[model samples]
Target: MAVLMEKKFPVEAGAYETAGEVSTTIKRTLKQLGVSAEVLRHVSVACYEVELNLVIHSDGGALTLQVEPDKVTLISQDVGPGIPDIGKAMTEGFSTANEEARTLGFGAGMGLPNMKRNATEFDIQSEVGVGTTITMSFALDMKG
Candidate 1:
């Protein structure tokens, strides 16, 4: 009784014009698959947060979605200038976004926090000069 679906989308830094497209597609796909509305909202928020992180932070990256009957998984992987201190980065309201990103009403430092809040489980890893990866999962039946 398990169903599986997977998808991947590319995200370019400073791609404001198309920043949320991937997340939107993911939302649509989940809706078509009959995912519950609550689960869909959580997935949509987390997906957009990760997508925006790539658009505003990384040089480039990919957002991946893996949906199973019990849970939905999101993995965001990006290249270059990785976080030096994940502890600080995770702190709500902490941001390192550039002026351009800030000017767009983004970079409020809410992306990571929002992602964590929306997902049932969350993990992040980074290496300076290398890259970063964030993994998040939402339980399909939970009241989250």
Candidate 2:
């Protein structure tokens, strides 16, 4: 599989001031690449959700974007203080976000569910103290 373009955005924990910048940029990048509207919508939503997760939870992380001939991939890798229960985390309305995040009108606990709903493919792996990683892929209409 050949990648047509790729970029990575760094995210810092508690950086609510610029939480959605990455996703905004990702959406723009996809649009510039001529990605279909449907695929762009899915990627943008999932990207924002995962980006917010990094801002609220991870010590720090990077969100990578890769555009292949037939797909667009987003991989989020974070450091330390990983999830304790993936099942519970995936459940709607369950959140461990701090007051800062909640105060900012975030941490509704719908991040994971929204990501899964928007992405064509989604996978998450987390450890007690080793941090978490999530990968999502959106299939594109390569014919166009």
Candidate 3:
């Protein structure tokens, strides 16, 4: 339950200029921490996917990465216009991305799916008028 290290990055909605910067920093930090390659890979993919979601979907959000002795946790909390249907959103090839986001080659409807695939554990919570919070955990062990 104790964190060994933690880093937080603020993501602005529609900030296409610096979408993946935080995820890049996270990968570097995990590598420097001597985390295994497999675990780092999972974390990197999920981190980027969630970060991009904040940029392309949320009004704005903050991403926090916490490293514990046994696991790595990536939490993304975003504000406003939350997802209406979690079931539909989870379906592949189902996207409601704006024209700008689609033009940028994003919003292929793979963000949530990819995050779920990469993380050992994934959970999401949201309300219609509120915000969305996604938490993904990667176990730092071979057994995972």
Candidate 4:
């Protein structure tokens, strides 16, 4: 389906200074669009998690926001140095984040797990030396 509204934000690697900015914008946009509170909260959490993942783990990436009549979708696609094991990456508390990322209070390893938990539908694909792509959707309906 065609997107009703869309925005893209570039996430620089290790850019802790500006982390969560994209997600903040997304949350505001959804609120302006009159998305339900429950769905907005879920999308906010998922978007923050994914955006932080891009800053902490990726070489660089862009987060895309798509709004449809029934749902909001967030897609994060990063450059090289992709994940080696998708299964391991999905595990809570399992993070490949470096000391730099960790020192900044990031890399707690909850990014992927939290995103999956908050999103109505989540998908992640990665290939070593290639890139990683994560897609998360939050439904507009009040029912989970």
Which candidate number has the best lDDT?
A: 3
Q: Please identify which of the two predictions, 1 or 3, would achieve the higher lDDT against the true structure.
A: 3
CA lDDT of each prediction against the hidden true structure: 0.90, 0.91, 0.92, 0.87
Assess the local accuracy of residue 54 in candidate 2 as a C-alpha lDDT between 0 and 100. Answer: 95
Candidate 4 residue-wise lDDT at 11 = 92
lDDT of 4 by residue, 32-99 (tens): 98998889989998888888888888899999999888888899999968988889888989988888
Worst lDDT 10-window in candidate 4? 135-144
Per-model TM-score on C-alpha atoms = 0.95, 0.95, 0.95, 0.93
lDDT for predicted candidate 1 compared with the true structure: 0.90
By summed lDDT, the worst window of 10 consecutive residues in model 1 runs over 1-10
Query: Among these predicted structures, which one has the highest TM-score?
Result: 3
| Residue pairs in clash, model 3 | none
RMSD to true structure for each model, in Å: 1.4, 2.2, 1.3, 1.3
Task: Quote the positional error of residue 65 for candidate 1 in Å.
Answer: 0.6
Give the Cα-based TM-score of candidate 4 against the true structure. Answer: 0.93
* Model 1 / residue 11 / CA error / Å: 0.8
